[model samples]
Target: MKKIFAILMTVSITYFASSQSKTFPIASTLTTIDGETINSNTFKHDGPIIIDFWATYCKPCIIKYNTLKDKYAEWQKRTGVKIISISIDPASRVESAKKFVEAFEWPYEMYFDLDSELISKLNNGSKVVPLTLIYDKDFNLVHKSTGASVLYEGSAKKGVKHLYSGKKEITDFTVDLSKYFEIIDQIISK
Candidate 1:
């Protein structure tokens, strides 16, 4: 799988570098799955935003989604943060975006950036999936990474906390978000 993925990325990068034209262009917002407008201003009033650029076929990407979906509420309550997932699977995969959401119902938001307009700017030109970006309230790019959050939780959290509060450490992965959301649902039902 690693070899296959590496080949694909290599192919993609090569193809883009050859034919993708000049520097990548970043569009503010196009349209989300739920038909909501998600742009730079959508987070104008919010704190640090975690933008996850992913696709429905990416398993590691889904793992990150499951994690954020589970801990999202607490992340909001504890830090007033927001997670925006942008799908970059091309225009043909838009339906998968909807199906993926229904299969795993997360309270967070997901946008269909099929062409990767906004996602391209995430890394300042790299069209990498699962690249999460942490930006300050003023929209200054703080940390931009291109990997799973679980593997990079320590660093991701450190930067997140630096922007969230005076704390030295942020939340860890052992928190079990899937079960966290489940418990919250159970309490709400009570």
Candidate 2:
């Protein structure tokens, strides 16, 4: 009986700790494009936030950014969702990362993880580009996905053409962002 009670108590404690770990990491430090230092709390109150991790060298990251560039404005207007793009580049590439952002003129809030400290805290030091995390109004993590947006791609004969199934090359792909958008919509509606 004593052993069973002890095991149950241990399980309860572990469950509580894991559940509580979903909150945004207040200790995380990130640098703005202009070199201003900021922490996770800086945006905690502004929930329904999307934190997108990227690097200067990640092609999928650039593709993802370009794919969402135009929709960002509409998303903000519709859901009041705030997107924060953070560069996970090493310290040496910080300048290049800034230049890349400038050249693209990305409109969302931008920052850099010089030492990847924020990335480590939020992503368990995974350091993978194109990692996206969505936090709720209360700053609890609601969703997380790694890699670029899901792309629907297929191949077929040259003569195959249709309204919803047309193709120019052997393989055509389209970014699927509805999943993220739906999650954001749900988060705000809650």
Candidate 3:
């Protein structure tokens, strides 16, 4: 009886200990355009993260995101990968960010580095628009680059596909359609 009880206790303890997920240090606290503070520290680390840095006035940024926004959800489901769009636009442009989201009708979460400190720390003092930073489940840097799309390999979707599929054969990052989502409409329809 004593032996059985001891073994059961050990198994129970180990199961509980292993089940808790470890949180990552992506964003401590992010402010929303509606004046709300959301701590991104609780992101579900089930998979890697795709962080895109952008600004409202950036034409290229808009174009890149236009491509990104359409396929955000499909990517989330296909691989459990998620995107955290961080806006570099000024605080004054906070409203613009929110308006832009509304106009485009996107469902992904949006944010801005109002203090600009997050961008500096994450990218090592290099402030650039449309920067995509990929991190592993353990909070390790996978890929970092400044461009309209994550061109480390072929395109942004390729980066996402590579991360989820675990096809290490490809040394470059690209975004493939089957592993991503896409937007179909831009003009306000009748």
Candidate with top lDDT is: 2
Cα distance off (Å), candidate 1, residue 22: 29
lDDT for each residue of candidate 1 in 1-190, tens digit (9 for 90 to 100) = 9999999999999997666323212447667786666664444434555666888766557656765676678767865566777788877878878887787787766777756777666566677777766655445565655765343243334243232343432233322244333433433343
- How does model 2 score by TM-score? 0.72
Cα deviation in Å at residue 3, candidate 2?
Answer: 50
lDDT of 3 by residue, 55-162 (tens): 876545655665566576775676566677888777788888888778767666677778776788778888787677776655566667675433334533425334
- What stretches of model 2 exceed 4 Å from their correct place? 1-24, 150-174
Candidate 1 vs. true structure, TM-score: 0.60
Which residue runs of candidate 3 sit more than 4 Å off their true CA positions? Answer: 1-11, 149-190
Cα TM-score per model? 0.60, 0.72, 0.68
Clash tally for model 3? 15
Among all windows of ten consecutive residues in candidate 2, which has the lowest summed lDDT?
155-164
Candidate 2 residues 1-190, lDDT tens each? 9999999999999998665524455677888888888876666445588889999887567656766777989888888888889998877899998887777678878888888888777778688878898888667789999875435443222222321343332124334577889999899877
Error of 3 at 124 (Å): 0.8
**Colliding pairs, model 2:** none
Off by over 4 Å in 1: 1-26, 35-42, 149-190
In angstroms, give how far residue 106 of model 2 lies from its true place: 0.6
